[model samples]
Target: MFNITQWSLKHWLAAALLVFFALFPLSGDLFYTSLLNRMIVMAIAVASLNLILGYGGMISLGHAAFIGIGAYSVGIPAYYDIYNGWLHLALALIGCGLFAFVTGAISLRTRGVHFIMITMAFSQMAFFAFVSIEEYGGDDGLVVNGRSEFFPFGDIENNVTLYYVSFIVLVAVLYLVYRLVNSRFGGVIQGAKANERRMRAIGHNTYKYQLTCYVISGMMCGLAGALMANFSNFISPDMMGWVRSGELIFMVILGGSGTLFGPLFGTGLYLLLEEFLSRSALYTFVTENIAFLNDAQPWVYWQLPFGILLILVVLYARGGVDGFLSRWGSKNG
Candidate 1:
């Protein structure tokens, strides 16, 4: 009943990407592979944001607060000797969900720009709360004792194994998001996004739908944060900072917000640029004659490239990289 030829191009492309990632360990050095891990984790977070912004039409500037909640969920528990691996992750998701529920309830009361402002306010509140918690390294941040281990085998600290773990989780979360967006509930959310008045006219509770999507997005972002903390063995208030939130938004916008694979591409692009800049500075000494060029801090001027790229994307590629590719494909086909 199932024919490979009948599969959509997007499905085929997703399959190809998955296969490529599966074999990536064999094709690249550990450093590159680790960078891939970070990209994939951040992509998961960005995709969660896309669910809210692209699907629900809720523009949240403070989404990083949920991520911070997730990271601290694991980090703080480990510090207190209350670590139970998956249980910690569950708690983080629950915490983010509750936070989103409460915040969305309040913020959704105000529409458009006001909603964004209220969300920003709550996110700042979360940032300050983490800063005030003198224990668990407070402002400095807490280093994870080690990567969490899966039960029975209990050796998940291995880098390669962690890569596979993260990959699997990324795949699973993406699939879950796809299903959520296609379901009946997802239709309501999307409807609300397209036209809140119409959704209300159809007897649907638009506010409830928006709030639900917001909570779901927050929970997913929180999950990514928990994994990120475990991956890096560190957690800090910086995770919840406004700039970090902006970066996440940048990832979504760069990748093509509505496309499932766009966030992955965006995160990959951003991290690759970051890794390149960081490594370029390390290699600067090799060109001793460069003089002043070598003297400058690579990161100090990194924002120029990103800012320029953002301007280009906004002016030309409104739908982002994935959208650009889609347009190209349609023309060629």
Candidate 2:
């Protein structure tokens, strides 16, 4: 849909990454492919949060609850011997939209830290609610018996098939969000973020715009959750934990909160950094070599470096990774 001449560096990078991933499965490296698959799923979740947080300025910390809902839609259904892919997806979307509608209506009434705290409280409510359900494994978690099946030819049990499906979903989400942020509804949401009182003064129902945006965001995140459950073959209260929400927030901000494709970059960066820190032999060697770190577990201190990087980004780069890339062109990705 985009013209080549108008494309920026970030645009080119996005295209290149897509090409890479499309061909990555052909290499037959299951480990990295699965890792990238997980990245694809998290990227979708991050993008959903970006819709409300970046454009609508909702700053919700409860988005992970929606993800949990989507996962449970799949897990619970599978528990009852229902393995229909379309049904799971339908449930995920419906559940997330309903929860977002009810919660968003109430949460939107507040502002600033109150909004964040209230959302977090709601997320914890969902987390514990699931934890209390022993029949579904509760705190231990629920297992997905099999991958979803959409058609006779559509089998998600194969990693390659799932990767392509996730990739297509990622592309569709990007295009949909791009169209949304540039549309009339997007303008109203952004306008509300800028000045709600003025938007209301001009006859716009700011609350409606924000709540609708929130619901749409939740639905999209629920889709990601469905994919995630398929990928991990498991679901738990931990998926809805506030910490996961915080991590999603970190990804959005790190990649450029308000811009297109920011979530992809942010999530990719966050996961890659975590992967490195979590399994880096270099860290082990350095820690063992350095006397001061000899007694310290190398993996235990990954956050120190990560925290410092985040601080640096916050201090020096307001637009995040995508924003930094935007500097190369007049267009924002």
**Against the hidden reference, what TM-scores do the models get?**
0.91, 0.94
Question: Residue 285 of candidate 2: its Cα lDDT?
Answer: 71
lDDT of each residue in 1-333, candidate 2, tens digit only: 389987788888878888887799899999999999999999999999999998889999988998899999989999998989999999999999999999999999999999999999999999999999999998999889898889766769888899999999988898889999999999999999999899999999888889999999999999999999999999999999999999999999999998888998899989999988756776667777889888886667777777887899878877999888877555534
Give the TM-score comparing model 2 with the true structure, all chains together.
0.94
RMSD of 1: 2.8
Backbone clash total, candidate 2: 0
Best prediction by lDDT: 2
Clashes of 1: 0
For each candidate, the alpha-carbon lDDT, in order, equals: 0.82, 0.91
Q: Candidate 1 residues 107-148, lDDT tens each?
A: 999878998888999999999999999887888999888666
